[model samples]
Target: MNEGDERALKVAVLGCGAVGSQVVRLLTEQRDDLAARVGAPVELVGVAVRRLDAPREVDVPAGLLTTDATELVSRGDVDVVVEVIGGIEPARSLILAALDNGASVVTANKALLAEDGPTLFEAAAKAERDLYYEAAVAGAIPILRPLRESLAGDRVTRVLGIVNGTTNFILDRMDTSGAGFSEALEEAQELGYAEADPTADVEGFDAAAKAAILASLAFHSRVTASDVHREGISEVTAADVASARDMGSVVKLLAICELRPGPDGQDQVAARVHPAMIPRSHPLASVHEAYNAVFVESEAAGQLMFYGPGAGGAPTASAVLGDLVTVARNRLDGTRGAGESAYADRAVQPMGETRTRYHVAIDVDDRAGVLAAVANAFADHDVSIQTVRQEGRGADAQLVVVSHSAPDSALSATVEQLREMDIVREVTSVMRVEGDAE
Candidate 1:
């Protein structure tokens, strides 16, 4: 090893929870290998935790554990700071301080990045330091780097996939076991796949944050969590899942980011997170249980799929270590990797104006002209139906209609009109259809 490689590079860790514990374990077990890869001995200088007396998963040296996170990052000798403390306030402040103190950062805080990434990027740029967060979006999956580097030259038209494992597990249970939303959620919680509150994952907030990060990277725009249109799987019923199965499809919570034309004919981005029906043949439909998958479509690379364990202590730590090694290498070389690239600065398209397809199921009177009246409702909104199926149960009937690609506003208007019709008893289900040609 060269003289510079002989010197140790110091690392500070914030938060000693699930991901942080696994990260510390990896750093200790693979210290020699990491040193050979980065051309410098990677050192764990300190670990900042909430309490020094708290029980930990890994055997952290008592001397290295400190509660003063602010002071740990502020230390001038620290060369890199690993932050797994999620949320907005302290994580954000510490990251900024680390960059300003001339230390590169590796983080797994998706909410922080999606909420206010520009602030961190600007700090890194001003300090000439690297801010790498590969563990943010999809746990161990190597999706972000590909979007930022491998596919940099190609024009990405769409990125649609499942980003949250908790939500996916619940939805998959509902499909495979024919259980309702509550039953599936109960199972997920029992298996430790979901939290007691599960609000962030079940209600789509987790996926929405990931979607914002994906849109910003794929489109080179500054997309935030507030910009994503989010809907959860809480309202998904067994009837909806059966409806999808009837059409040879399955329901999955999806984060979709696409480049569409704006009112001015310029390309704009639309990012949304919701439960959608995809054909059984689609690669994403096979992602079961707690696994996650992403499908990317570009001008040159027709279709690419990334699948793996989306969340876990060890899986997430793997991504964190990957970024740590890269940043360490850059530090030894006296250089920095690429920073945020928002040069495109494109506008975000409104959800109402976005074009998509819908699957609607209605309970109507089994009488003449009922189908005609329902067809007229769609016509009033200028929405055309692609396929229609009818089933009779003597006094009443059920109608299933799938519409072609149309403005979301128009599809919603048609559903509202059908609900008010005298012959229509109820609109049983309404869901968007994806993974098919428009």
Candidate 2:
């Protein structure tokens, strides 16, 4: 190979769908800028697609498209592999093959990363190659890089945010328009904010994947999707939204990861994705529509917020390109970026042991001793009540109780016991309270 060819970094993209096409566009349109930034030419060597004739959003040059992803990444001349083909099997195998073949990788596969990130990270480490995946967590918001790079020196205590755009859009609609969960979800589908199935986003699988990624980065530990406690927002009713409004709050599906003490007094990781009521004044509560925001709390940094378009073909592609430039530059420099940081390797706390506040609304008999009985149920589980409000009189009576921070298991037991109580007419709504106290 000539000196010019040796200096030029060859990039193989292993997908030609939404994100893949946009990546191709940026690589072609910003070729000059990318070359300058990398201190060398960046070339799109090949694009691996499932179908050659399939229509694409961007025009991939002739002779660059291929159906064989393995062959494309295995080519000796390929210096960088960008894997936009999301999923576990093929994407994982292709990425591993690329790293083994001595090429750095940039991927936007959150599910793969969340499920089996350590495998990819180990592969890259063994090959002495960079594995940059800033696009995996929050799209163009740049949260992963900050957690991996910028905030490396700071001790992050907690990571909380609305990381899923589909669920956020649905919840935002429900909050703003008093739409039921089904109605809001329908509107989201109509607007293209949600998929036809919508199971992944609405059922909290998407956010759980993202939560695992965030927990791994923030705590410098290995966290997987199974370790994350997930709860979908499909059960959120219009009455729940109205209840939140009455309390000066709004409901949002949140990805929360925290570092807390374990039973042995050692630090443990607690990561959960669920719908919760947050004060309107909170940063995450203000995140509306399809936008994403992450609020970070650390020992030295105090508080930091990263916000932007959480997902979209173009926005995600922007992150992929950013990582591409970084990996390409590293290739030219004969250096590698930071691999996975699992030095802490903390234990993942059980969902039952995790601590948080709860808002429980219960319909009860409008007779004497109802308040005492409810308070006793909470006390029986060692759950402390922070505030209580009673509405209506006689048969129309309802008791809304918000609790102080307590173990989730204890709060859950209290709610269960309340359900069995004869004095309790019905458990109207139960939601975890976050951000602020009443």
Winner by lDDT: 1
Candidate 2 Cα outliers beyond 4 Å, as residue runs: 1-6
* lDDT of each residue in 1-438, candidate 1, tens digit only: 233767799999999999999999999999999998888889999999999999989999999999999999999989999999999989999999999898999999999999999999999999999999999989999999999999999999999989999999998999999999999999999999999999999999999999999999999999999999999999999999988998999999999999999999999999999999999999999999999999999999989999999999999999999999999888888888989999999999999999999999999998889999999999999999999999777566899999999999999999999999999999999999998867
User: Candidate 2 lDDT, tens digit per residue, 409-428?
Assistant: 99999999999999999999
Clashes of each: 0, 0
Per-candidate TM-score against the hidden true structure = 0.98, 0.98
Error of 1 at 386 (Å): 0.5
Instruction: List the global CA lDDT of all models.
Output: 0.95, 0.93
Alpha carbon deviation, residue 108, candidate 2 (Å) = 0.5
Ten consecutive residues with minimal summed lDDT in candidate 1? 1-10
Candidate RMSDs in order: 1.2, 1.6
Runs in model 1 with CA error above 4 Å?
1-3
**Clashing residue pairs, candidate 2?**
none
CA lDDT of 121 in candidate 2?
A: 94
